[model samples]
Target: EFLFSSLVETSTAAELAEKLRADVSPYWAVHYRFGKSAANLSATALAASSLDALLINVAAPLRYAYLRQQGTEDYRERSIEFLCGIKPENNRLVRAFGKSLQPVDASESQALIQLYREYCERRKCFFCRWGYRFLSLSAR
Candidate 1:
């Protein structure tokens, strides 16, 4: 928590990445507590996948949301730039969506998940902009 708080206060994405690797690694090494079966982990013990997961799932979303809420276009663009610059995630949903719609990075994958959960799963096609437009055209 201390590492993340310090990391989050940084003014730029590069700083955040640096703090995550440098500061967070030591914190994880000393205080990281996983299940009993898992071995005690050091800074070097953490995998790229774990850090990528944090970047994708937590940092990007929060940054984008805060920028959007504040109505700042430049910061929003920065948030997106940070997201698109990250490595792509490979999971079942990303793979499934990739068959038809390839997600170039973690941001697109997150967008697909949001679309599926918020629109597709709820059957809210009428409320979707593309779906509403398609329906209007079909009716015309």
Candidate 2:
């Protein structure tokens, strides 16, 4: 867990899965047969599985606990991209932003997703770039 957390803190999303698998393999090999098969796992599958496990088993409970004690402020910077109930398009859009924006970190990605949900999904066009342009043109 510590190694996984360290990788999360230091590695990019692309690097996290392979790093986690490499780092955990020895321990896994000693304890479970599944660990032996992990070597054949694709990076995409590993990342998705690891993310699901972390979010469901670790992050959700921790967020709930923190919310109970101190409220949302404590988790304001945390990423909710993979959490249940979020639309998959939000995650895909964030990835697209990363490609176009070139270096969108977790917090920035979260902010972009929030902006998309609040403005794009809700059709708050005047507040968004394309919307503002459209509104201005219509006004003209």
Candidate 3:
């Protein structure tokens, strides 16, 4: 309920993180204990955990579901925009790509991620935009 509500209300990644921290952290402390976990954790730690859950468990699946249902170029673009708006920094894949380059704005980062997901990870480089360009240059 909270996760769905947060997604509906928040537009940006930072906003989602903040909302998770504010609204979910208290309940998280009580219900989210792991084996032998500390009885008390700082607010920061709880907030981080909540943010991770929202991004990974909630947002990512929702984004993919939207893409599967819509199945159009425009919808794909919108899904990417929605994912990018949600704190790409919190995502390990995005962070790794950021380190490889000097910096990447949200759109560039999302594009790279999309490319990776759709082509690179699938070993479909021949069909990838960058791969196609590289292959064409090599052929020349």
Candidate 4:
């Protein structure tokens, strides 16, 4: 059982991600952000992978190592897998923000906040539904 589990764990998720990159690597491009990875899918061009075992927490949204790679205008409706953290919290904020959150489609619903409020100020002004409502008003 140990050997089997080890074999399964050996396959990193990045390998599948790399394969996804190869099929559409050279022809694609991203427009915003500051540096190289900001415009490219990632470093190392991805690596080979196979999945023999999987582990997940279905109760929470997923996370990605390079979370900033997720952009608003890229796709219309999508859900992310293989992401590594707390995503449902983001989803809650977006839901409260309504349309001012533009690119309000399902694809980008679980994005983390770009700017965070001060910890001393209380998460009330930071992570609350009211905060999202406030941001939505200004974004318009």
Candidate 5:
């Protein structure tokens, strides 16, 4: 948390964020929207789980299921390579969680990819209440 505060208060958040991402790692302190996870990602408990992508799916919470980490077979799905647009006020996840951006395992990215693969095979997302909520809403 202190790391983020110092970065924010330094008037150089953008610079630091870029530096971190250049390493091909998501910033642990933000709420980035990589895509969405196929498994449950809304409980807050799993919000920062090692297998959890730092990104959140606001428009479609079930989009969480669609998010991919760097090492996942579908990791390419989560790549923000083609993004270009007028972003919303809170596009990145960092602003949402920086205040308590605890230190995550440096190995989180790999672990998350594995978990995502397992989650996909089981197709347990259909059982996720949050997933059901997103699915139901899409029909409307």
Candidate 6:
């Protein structure tokens, strides 16, 4: 909500950074403690994990969509490169997909997610890479 509300068509990196900084609330820092000891708790305003997840799932995908719509390859490739740079999020879906192939970064993870959602779930084996390979062989 905060990101989309603040984001504009011409938003700059500095502007986005400022919005993130401003959106941070200090109430948690003053009121909350993780454990009996303060040493175990985080005092920072920003949650690194949450931010990383947002960047991977939201920002990168939106960037790819925008770049793809513009019919350009450079920035589209850069967006994928950004995804490839980030670490993959660990979850049941990712783990399930990992049974057959390992995802080295967010790009591979995202690709696997798309494959599962669009092809596997729909049982569109003919459209999937591995599935297509086996299907072609059996058709011969």
lDDT scores of the candidates, listed in order:
0.68, 0.49, 0.59, 0.35, 0.32, 0.65
Score residue 53 of candidate 4 by CA lDDT: 16
How does residue 125 of candidate 1 score in lDDT? Answer: 76
Per-structure clash totals for the candidates: 0, 0, 2, 2, 14, 0
Order of the predicted models by lDDT, top scorer first: 1, 6, 3, 2, 4, 5
Pick out the ten consecutive residues of candidate 4 with the lowest summed lDDT: 50-59
lDDT of 4 by residue, 26-53 (tens): 4343323434434455533323221111
Model 2 misplacement above 4 A: 1-45, 48-61, 64-90, 95-103, 129-140
- Residue-wise C-alpha lDDT for candidate 3, range 4-119, written one tens digit per residue: 76664455566766665654455555454644445665453545645655664577567557657656556555555565654334466556444544223445555667777888
User: Model 2: per-residue lDDT, tens digit, 6-98?
Assistant: 433532333433444544444454454543554553333344555645544455445545554555563433434323222223357556444
Pitting candidate 3 against candidate 5, the one with the higher TM-score is 3
Rank list by TM-score:
6, 1, 3, 2, 4, 5
Best by TM-score: 6
| Best lDDT among the predictions, by candidate number | 1
* TM-score of structure candidate 1: 0.59
Give the local distance difference test score of model 2.
0.49
**Across residues 29-124, which tens digit of lDDT does each residue of candidate 5 receive?**
233455533343333323222212222222112222334322346423322211111122221322322333322332332333333355434666
On the 0 to 100 scale, the lDDT of residue 118 in model 2 is 77
For model 2, the run of ten residues with the poorest summed lDDT: 81-90
- Against the true structure, what is every candidate's RMSD? 5.8, 8.6, 5.6, 16.1, 19.1, 6.1
Using all chains and alpha carbons, the TM-scores for the candidates as numbered come to 0.59, 0.39, 0.49, 0.21, 0.19, 0.60
lDDT of 3: 0.59
The local distance difference test score of model 4 is 0.35
Clash-forming residue pairs, model 2? none
Question: How many clashes would you count in candidate 1?
Answer: 0
At residue 73, candidate 6 shows an lDDT of 59
